[model samples]
Target: MNRPPSNILGKGWLYCTVFLTGAAVMVIELLGTRLIAPFYGASLYVWTSLISVTLIALALGYYWGGVWADRARSGLSLIIAIAGLLTIIIPWLTGPVLLATDPLGLRLGSFVSTLILFSPSLIMLGMVGPFAVKLSTATLAKVGASTGSIYAVSTVGSVIGTLFLGFYLFPVVGSREIFIGLGIALLLLAIIVAYIEHRHLKSAATTIPTALLVVIGIGLYPQIANSNRAESNESFQTRFERESLYGWVRVIDKPKENIRLLTVDASTIGAASISHGENLLAYQKIVTLLPALAPEMKRALLIGQGAGHMAMTLKDYGIVTDTLEIDPAVAEASIKFFGFVPTGKTIIGDARYEIRQLKGPYDLIILDVFTGGSEPTHLLTVEALAQLRDLLTNQGILALNFVSFLDNGQNATLASVAKTLAQVFPHQQVFIADPDTDFNDFIFLATNHAMNLNDESFPDSHRTWLKQRLVNIDQSQGMTLTDNLSALERLQIRKSEHYRRMIIDLVGTNHFIR
Candidate 1:
């Protein structure tokens, strides 16, 4: 890579082009995920598929362009012209493709969404390199040098793109606008590159096809504006559809008790409902139903808050709550759909990361990180439990949600998790959801304080619910999953090789969660 050559673009222009192209690639790749993720779940599988398709397309472009460059070697003008086309087309197509991706995302799931939504744009992105090298090629002997330099530029561009998108672009401007902006930038660069080379336009035999393509691209722009129009139910009261780095957040206003928070990837989190047509600020936990559950409980934190469900619920119970959630889209959705109001102190980074970052002296923390079968493995580890413990005051408690099936009701994962919790906290008790209520779910209360299942501290409603149910422990069929608990004990085991493999595992191949 360091081998010197008879450089043509020189240190200045060459470096500039490399950074620009590299930035474009990174923008397209990373931002493309943002573009698609708004419609689909921003799961690792989705990322794997998108990145895979892009890499494959790039390899094909490399091969084809390497061969084509031999003949098309002297046309910097042609290269720029095509790049320009890409710029225009990409912006124009943004709305259509993303809109087209919605129902398609639903039908195909996140995996297919990645392919259907991003493949074409990624392919277009893939073709940029070969043409750049072909246009810049000075001599047959310098082919390697030309290609290397262009690629170096493209990579640097990518690094810039990544930093820009992650830190500023996503947090500030909307995702749709960013897509359009990048497209325009690419188009201008292409035209500029062509003129800088002082070359006339190439005579294309198929001008009509080219014209049609441009027209089609121009038509795609409006799709961006229209893709975000209204609620699926056609309710006039619904207001917004915003896209973020994580996914889309839509707000629907109805004469209801709470605003509904919907994650593009999962089920609804919470609803912003109205009381007597007036918005109520009260949290709806109704924790008073369980005699054992207390309102004046110590400091509290909620992980994986969707529209501030647990946070608001706990807040209703008079517990000081802190929330940590990964997606900003979800946070926005909470304000837009659910009546839950957060006090701006809610952490916006990845939940686990933010939890580690916080200066915690919390008395209670709610663990709802499990996205059903796709629970975060790291959070279930002993180390994570220990960290949570570290943040807890002496009497602090952790409320964990464990899912269970209604049929014959046996949960290996919950048992395993319980085993781990027992290791962490000696004073722990479990409150299971009604067995016949369809979900064999349980909420494990872990704290240093002696919690009384029959304590007078329970709210009247919670006490009534607890009074009707009997506490039964299934010591027979279960595994307490902990950091030390090996996967072999479960019926399913993971042998994943990469992100793609892990996704497949999430879908279950004799794996317990699938």
Candidate 2:
């Protein structure tokens, strides 16, 4: 094995370059999810595409990098620098690419978007490992040591990048800014390595103009992102937007109606009209009426407190409600923008884990957890329903809110959930909040004992609505959603597509501008 001239950059500098490039690769991978989440949702398919593309790109880069390292020893720094520059450019290009691909629908569009924006940069970053190994090995005897040292350093960098970006940097800075900063840092490192190796003034001269151009581009990003937002409908103004651990949370305001809506990713989770003090969403109002259906209603467990609309309604009805929300930012935004006062005890954690820890024989338990228009399928499995059944009182009702088509043959998610509930509870009743529509809210009410729909405790209007919208599901045609064989996410692909289109229609575009 022929080694390059001993005058090449110091081993320390080479190791540092490998570490930084490794960190950048992971950062870009994580940010890619955030980039496409607002449009396609961070679904299983979306994640699978992103991860698979990244690994494939890295594999290709390793092969190409090793070949290049042997053929052209001096070009390693240039390769790393080029990769860094490309990574920087990706964030800027993402908005346009998403807009252009909006017509492709979710599955195909998400795959294409990740492939276009993430693959090239990742492939380049992957080259750092083999390139570093080649440059650091001084002799045949030291090759093993050199390779292990470089890989260990690179892995450490990946761990730091993952933890820091996820826990700190992502929450404090905008995703666009983070990408720009990472790019600038990587570019500077590349320039430094080139100057160290060759003592070339021309490398510095070339880097100055490129750095300035990157800065200028960073300055223009806000305007470009804003222009992208101009494609959305101007009817509603976005009052607040934040990327949380759960997903993208936005509080949109309809000034004319005095309505403030809380949307997670592209799906509207909760809404409240300032003019009406109570809940304005029809589904929310329906859930609140659960106490009326049950004989006793003292304590209630409300899972997934999006904007706290249902929790507030339950509290107003004299039920001591305990709310559980996975994302703390959501609960904070709910109180700040959506008039959610923290009257009840709010627990911040995953509902599945928290539900198991809680000791409950409550009158009502409402499951309304949805992120990016899809429910966490794990929470809808047969085992989950059985756990929920154990928490309910003997005559207590378990109410679930699901969005699906209710036209008999078109409602797989709804029917599957109903069938699963029947397996645990003796009686299950389905109510379509808007029976006339093709796609609407389908509320499922389940209980161990038969529910008395004729209970005069319910308001006459609610009773009338329930009678009109009740769906008689034939269990023979539906499949139970189990932990091992849950198809809720797959079955709801059409609804997810519809959600994308509906958002595009509502906002006049499917992409997230901010």
Candidate 3:
């Protein structure tokens, strides 16, 4: 069994190792979501998989660490060194692991991919806490205090790491860079611990080469990943890519099809034609037609400024529009690539919070929010609908863009949304963008008064299509989602899974998964 450190400096170094390892654990857990988001999406299932895998890995590590601490002569250096190596190799392992697990479907695929990619490093990091507790304990009497102090320090590290990554690092740093930097830090930490313990550079002979490998990996891996991304695929070409807190924001252009798409995670937010810079999405067209529903529509509020298509569309009709978009990266991409100029005041925040902040009596309030293959449950609740209702004028129209099946077989989530909306605006009319399929972009136009459309200005095709696909939603078909209780995430798992698969099928997986 190992003896406790003899000096204060030695003990301090040991505790530092514990702190860094604790931080690394939380960082890896959060970064795992970003890594998988491009391919599998940051869906509810993906989060569940990563979270569940992290807990399991930690549990196993805790048990193994306690046993090892009692039996082994060294402290946490070797475990940390091994973990660092595994962490460094994650970017390399990610592509292969995702490819192999792709056939497992979203839930199982994401769970298995996370297990394969993160479990080993997490298990090693988990060993740090128990080992630190063991190494710091001096006597049987003081063991309790030592354990408590060490754990408290570790928890503090975790808290700091969570805040740092979420608030700062996520927007600026790439996932691979963050992973490599973390791995290198851990490696250097292992060396420090070894030097403190042995009082010579000789003890770190094994770890020195491993650290060098991590350095080389950091340099070479990016080139390899970039080369793969730059592969000559005739189907599509990636024009822009940025990893943000919201999702993996990408602008993919299909020259053959003459389309440019703005995709976040697994969902395409907007698409524009290459030759003409016009928005090519059916939902955007339907939304543009919304102003015709209210001829005196002077002011509008657009939630989810996706590529700023609908916002720009409203601006074209001489309406003063305010936009609420969460991701700054998305806003940047929309303007730089899609030629979207913000016509009015643009607020960069979540819809729920920003909606509360707005002092609006808007004639048109559009709800076109979607993230990670599903609508945010918090924004779709009855309480959220009430907020939107309060913001609208008496004759104002609230047009919601939703993706779900119109048929009874797979329409539970859709029905729930319809039910929630009806609670606030009872007079609602639903229209399908594509009548050929059950799963289509369903636009719900809600108003306090009876719905009437002035088709005089609209083209013959637009007028005919609008009249043909008008659908009546059965509001009592599902449960009401509210702030107190929400099963929207649970109810949307299957729908999200289907949506993910459809995206993969439409655009080949290499652009995302690789």
Candidate 4:
């Protein structure tokens, strides 16, 4: 038997094609999250949908590609080229697809949107692997070597893609631009491969103009979409917007209400009214009560600086406030737009990690970190709480601002977190921002010393309200949130879903599209 031709292209072109296709696959997966996050939020449900869709698409593509390889070896380039083109089209379609499905709820809406926008491109790209193996193999004897070599090359490409996109591309460029760049890269690769395999000048020539048109369309889509969103709601205006390592950050100004809102991944993290120049959110205002409850308030540490409203408020009371904010972009925006001044210091890093390295025996420590509408589970663990406790002075107080529902079964996370805090601090007090509402801020104040709610420093108006909402000290019993057993993510999802529904009802679906 003839050794089917020792080489496909003289020098390693097949490997390069496989490598590029691999890179494209990972790019789609990573950037897909950012693309949908603004509409559905970057929650467990959104991530789960994106991953599940990619796997299912790849599985179907592998099967179909194998069958196609048996029938037409020459069609590999055409298949990949078409897939690249389709990938380009996906980003363009994202806005419309999300708008159409916004009413379906986060879980179902995200799943349907992922299926419609991402599956086709991923399936097509998945076909490249099996097809590459078929084309590269010279004979039955070398099948194993060919398969292994192609896969190894593809795997290496995936690693490069993940690292480059995550570390470099995402931080520098916006999500929509990243998608556009990936699509352009893939389309160019497809044209090159087609020319190499079939010497098809005619096909490549046609593809060039089509690629140009696609890029132009992508550039125009965002502007048009923004205009449409603005026309939909004249009262709400996006004052500032930027892509950050964590997610999309936006500062929206509601001129009618004289409020400026800070949002990360569609969750309202902070809001300050222009008229009062203070945090408009009820939960944030409640954090100010900490200084009144604690015995001493000279030095304070804030774990999260959402627009720095709470920190600024503390500064006004003559306390030295040091804020630790994870996202530098958020910290910068807070100062520039939200009246956050560096009254004491602004540390940029993770709250949990920074807390351990701090030289602190602070009089007050406030925990307000959140991501995608929920507290990060890592920061709520028993071990983390213990570390924070050690950073406080003997008379210091730790106040946590979190959102949870207090209706029996829905209060598991609230109970667990309070239990964990109690384990670290002997004396603890619970205050719900609103006693009438089940879903609202649940502030937990813990200290080694007993807290006096009747202290003269307490705000006169809030004294009675805070006293009324204090949970019975005996009721703070439940499973503690140790590092290993934290269920904050699951609990937060329930509240996030509720928030999504409320927003949709109040503003209509267009509120989410931008």
**By TM-score, who's the top model here?**
3
Q: What is the C-alpha local distance difference test score of candidate 2? A: 0.77
lDDT string, candidate 4, 270-319, tens digits: 88886776777786666566666663678989888888877778877788
Candidate 1, after superposition: displacement of residue 141 in Å?
4.6
Location of the lowest summed lDDT over 10 successive residues in candidate 1: 505-514
Q: Please list the Cα RMSD from the true structure of every candidate, rounded to 1 decimal place.
A: 7.4, 3.2, 2.9, 3.5
- Residue 422 in model 3: lDDT: 81
> What lDDT does each candidate get?
0.55, 0.77, 0.81, 0.76
Q: Total backbone clashes of model 2? A: 1
The TM-score values for the models, in the order shown, are 0.73, 0.90, 0.92, 0.90
3 against 4, candidate with superior lDDT: 3
Instruction: Pull out the clashing pairs in model 2.
Output: 233-507
Please give the lDDT score at residue 282 for candidate 3. Answer: 72
Instruction: Give me the candidate number with maximum lDDT.
Output: 3
Give the C-alpha miss distance for residue 355 in model 4, angstroms. Answer: 1.8
Off by over 4 Å in 2: 1-10, 140-145, 200-234, 455-460
Candidate 1 residue-wise lDDT, 1-514, digit = tens = 3222224444454456557756766676676666544333454555676777668766775676566646653343344334435544443454455455434433244445455544554555556677666656657888888788878777877877889888988778865567666665655554455444432233343243434444554566676445433224422244555565555555544433234324333323444444322223122232333213544465677887766756655555566677787777777767655655874367887755777787878867778755332345667766788889888877677777655433343445455666677777887766656645534446677777686656665566666665454334453455555555534112221111122233323222111010
